[model samples]
Target: MTTQGENIAERIKAQAVSLGFAACGIARADAAPRTADRLAQWLSEGCHGDMIWMEERAGQRGAPQALWPEVRSVIMLGMSYAPSRDPLALERACDIGRISSYAQGQDYHDVVKKGLKALARWLVEEAGGELKVFVDTAPVMEKPLAEAAGLGWQGKHSNLVSRDHGSWLFLGAIYTTLELQTDRQGQDRCGSCDACQRACPTNAFPAPYRVDARRCISYLTIEHKGIIPEEFRAAIGNRIYGCDDCLAVCPWNKFASSAAVNKAFLARAELVAPKLADILDLDDAAFRTVFAGSPIKRIGRNRMVRNAAIAAGNSGNGAYREQLERLASDDSDVVRDSALWALQRLSDG
Candidate 1:
């Protein structure tokens, strides 16, 4: 015989699936000890780089009750955005830009938030109780909570790796006063597989369990505010925003998220292997128009062009020489500096 709570949990899971989320489960709000310790050490080492928020809210992160004391239960959820195309093959082509799987469509934050809010509304209307839903926007330790809820286990990359969906799922959480039935906690299945670490182009993982963001290509290219170091320029390939090498290299991805987002994420005509020369020609208006909904829009034109300048230098295609020279004179100091660096590299070759 099922209790009222069990029925609610099952209905919630059913509605969550109906809403397009790939998986859902519930866990009692609790301290994520392992996640907490790692985050503490990472902050202690100052590895988060320019993201000061990671330090500012260190106390709230991974601490369920710290964010909201009444959080008796945590509902973990995932929405899959795995695109069916080859992100790797697209990188080498050098004509199309590669966007991370999550950035391809409408921001997952908006999509998931709407769904979570609806679920929370439903929970209140039917199940009755106070509840709060958070997409990745919160300090809540979503991955660990997802693990605790039996949705998945954290891979060596420390991202949640789901058995059914692979690592291609985006996670969100609902902190509630409801004492829901709990799912079994997941166990680490990464066992002896260092594929995620070995695949990093920047060697971001200082150790199997830790990622030093300073050494990560995604950090340098997207998150880091200043000039990219010369040593890593060539290795960055044509990846204009975020590198997928680590996530894509994970062997488990082959089994689970073996799909891709539709044409929205499919390398846009201009983005895929676009010539560095073509990108350098864009003015500010063009930049906004081109990547309107894309995450690349966040970096603005200066930084992106600066990155393009690096690609131009690495291009070795003498045809782009004039284009590189034009960017070498870009109004922004950052852009000119990168253009100059690429010009020198190209000239030397």
Candidate 2:
């Protein structure tokens, strides 16, 4: 060990907390054998679905050595992105849309990665070593690594859940050429709690600790390309972007906090529970204006409008037929098909 190794590690950890990460934990740049095998099995089971990229860096995801040959330690950090209110409550207000808590404000990738890079740069300058930072951008298995590092335990939904922040934390990792003291690993605390599994609108979790991304509403609205499967449409309700049912039902929110540093995390008053009728009227420009600087901007106008059309149809309100009918001729098959489905739901109702 170097003369100042412990001091360096302490400084790094302190600086991370100062940077507003709710919790920080470190692990040796080595693989946990059981976790490694489990990851391989998950890939083989094809649960990742349309996310082909998850398979690309399969080896590096589980083993830090696969990322950098000289990496001596892994520092995993968690920032509590938990909102002050429950996102699930909005679901019962079916006439209004329900955006996942994480997306209610700003895009986390930008904020979390920016903080990680700051800590990384500090390490290079103060510790005399090399470092790399990863947010959600790379092939990092952040949740597993964070769990191994002891920041939190993986809940039944397979997302990392902290006793402090619940399932509302965003995770990032830093790889370094310096050795650091590792944390005690946390155990699975899911117990008999199946709230996350039950809260899922589409039954995405076929079993505990496993999520079928193909059947997840978050996947359908955000990642999965092409028209969503017909069976999931009605169950999707008014969740246009992503679903947070699994995260919200965790019993840990009593200790969770509002993420104050990220000012953009404050929910946009209008977007939080926008009416399906009002959202469906947006053209491309209007959508851009409304969703600018938000994660929803990534999905574009038609996709969002298509979701609104479906929600309108499910609203059992016949007045929205004109708007839904106009979208039926849309060239984008996704929008057109959703319009057709909405029209049918409305007519039948």
The alpha-carbon lDDT assigned to residue 171 of candidate 1 equals 85
Q: Compared with the true structure, what per-residue lDDT tens digits does model 1 show for residues 199-231?
A: 887778888867888887788878877888877
Task: List the lowest-lDDT window of 10 residues for candidate 2.
Answer: 257-266
lDDT of 2: 0.82
Model 1, global lDDT: 0.78
Stretches of candidate 1 above 4 Å error?
257-275
Residue-pair clashes, model 2? 0
TM-score, model 2 to reference: 0.94
Distance from true position, residue 131, model 2, in Å? 0.9
**Of the candidates shown, which would achieve the greatest TM-score relative to the real structure?**
2
lDDT of each: 0.78, 0.82
Off by over 4 Å in 2: 1-3, 259-262
